[model samples]
Target: MIRDVAVLALEGSHAFELGVFCEVFGIDRSDDALPGYDFALVSATGDSVSTRHGFDVRTPHGLERLSSADLICVPAYDLRVRQPDRLAHELRAAAERGARVLSICTGAFLLGEAGLLDGRRCTTHWRYTDELARRHPRARVESDVLYVDQDPIITGAGTAAGVDTCLHVVRREHGSAVANTIARRMVAAPHREGGQRQYRERPQPREGTGSLAPVLGWIEANLDQNLTVEAMARHAHLSPRTFARRFQQEAGTTPLQWLTGQRVLLAQHHLETTDDPITAIARCTGLGTVDNLRHHFVRRLGITPQGYRRAFRAPHNK
Candidate 1:
């Protein structure tokens, strides 16, 4: 249901973070059978805003663009200076009017300044979690998760984690197929496993970096196959315990967790794209039984298969 998206450009905003919003929401991907956003960059103060990298980002749009936006995104910025009161006021008002608000990295500070983060479960860059907590004592700052989705407000941790949060929103609104297509175009993971806590212990993988790419590719291709820890361990040439540990280290999730998530995603694709019965879709996705599929779908997505199809199935397909 989300269509229009407006990204807020503020003084000293991080260029990469802003680019993350543009890349995810501003691009035209309809050629690839993906939905295109009615996207625009809006500045609160003027036509041009300065970035932390000593460059200015110029946009034709202004705060007025935000009024009709279905979602408003605020990217990371230097939080040392005060944000314009008008920007904060309008952001809070937008959320009040049922517009979802998303913040990347330290942009959570802007939400706190807007008083939107107060009494909500939120998070930010791990480096600033304590500061965010201290600044807004009323806000429950979770330092561990990749992102926290408290309905109207979604918060991403740092730079690339923004991708995870955005794709998550897409998956929630559309379906995994759309989200995964977008992820494929971006060459980013369709889903990430762990939290910033895991990243804190080690460096994040650089772009085009992943140790288990081959195994993961194999698993994805074989989602309907019976995959077990022992089977996957053999494929990865590691013992079961070693593979489990290495998988967590490399993928940020346990093997079974990843497999179940894949099955759910596969089930979602079937529900959205095919008129197959729930039992048939469950079997195709490797959930084995309709009850098993129902259990995982409801537990993970909070929606029954029929309900999800009702919401996201393509009109022509339906």
Candidate 2:
């Protein structure tokens, strides 16, 4: 549903966050059955905008370009820099008109300046969550999550999480199939739950203790099995309590939570690529039954399994 995409190019904007928006929406991928967006880089100043890296990006579009945008990004900028009030006003106007306004990293501050974060559950980078809360006290700052999707106002946490945040919008607007295709092309994870922790002590397992790396691969390969924390703990040669603690430390979420997210992802793929009924997918994904499948599909994707298949079933399968 989102076609017109515009990102603000402000002075001292973080290059990577700006590139995240450009990568997700700006590129034309129609050859891969994914169409590009009507994208623009809008700046409050003139065509040339300086980045934090000391490079300049030229974008002829200006603030007025935001008027027709279905999605607008306030990409990360210097946290200390003061943005123009008019920019904030335009962002508010965009939200009022039902356009989704997304903020990556510290860009949430600009949204706060626009009064868009008030009464909305939002977030920023983990390091700045406290500051975001202190500045925008009315905003509910969910500090640790990768991103917070408050519908018309979406906020992403630090740098790489921007990819997750943008792909989430892509998934919601198009379907998991489109989002997954985009992810595959980018060589990124197909999906990461927005509620997943933004920070983790160990992204990979510690060298000495049994590595969760292999355990994760095993879990993925055997998703149809009835997996439990105790079972996983045994496989890791660890006590259940220790495994649970280590999982939280390493994965940034509980074991079962990660398991469910993986199950849902598999179900999404099945629904898109196969003609099998929901019951079959449920069993194959370890979701057990049609009722359970529908429950998770609706809860996680905001669409029923049947509806997802209808919208995103591959052309050959359909």
**For this target, which candidate reaches the highest lDDT against the unseen true structure?**
2
Per-model CA lDDT versus the true structure: 0.86, 0.90
Which residue segments of model 2 deviate by more than 4 Å?
Answer: 205-209
Q: lDDT tens string, model 1, 1-318?
A: 789999999899999999989999999988888888899999976599989999999978989999999999999999875678899899999999999999999999999988998889998988999999998999999987789887799899988888898988888987887888899989998876324342633343333544666788888888878899999989978899998887777666678988998898888888899899998998878889989999998987889988999989988886
Clashing pairs in 2: none
Clashing pairs in 1: none
Q: What is the lDDT of residue 34 in candidate 2?
A: 87
TM-score of 1: 0.89
Stretch of 10 with least lDDT, candidate 1: 193-202
Q: What is the lDDT of residue 19 in candidate 1?
A: 95
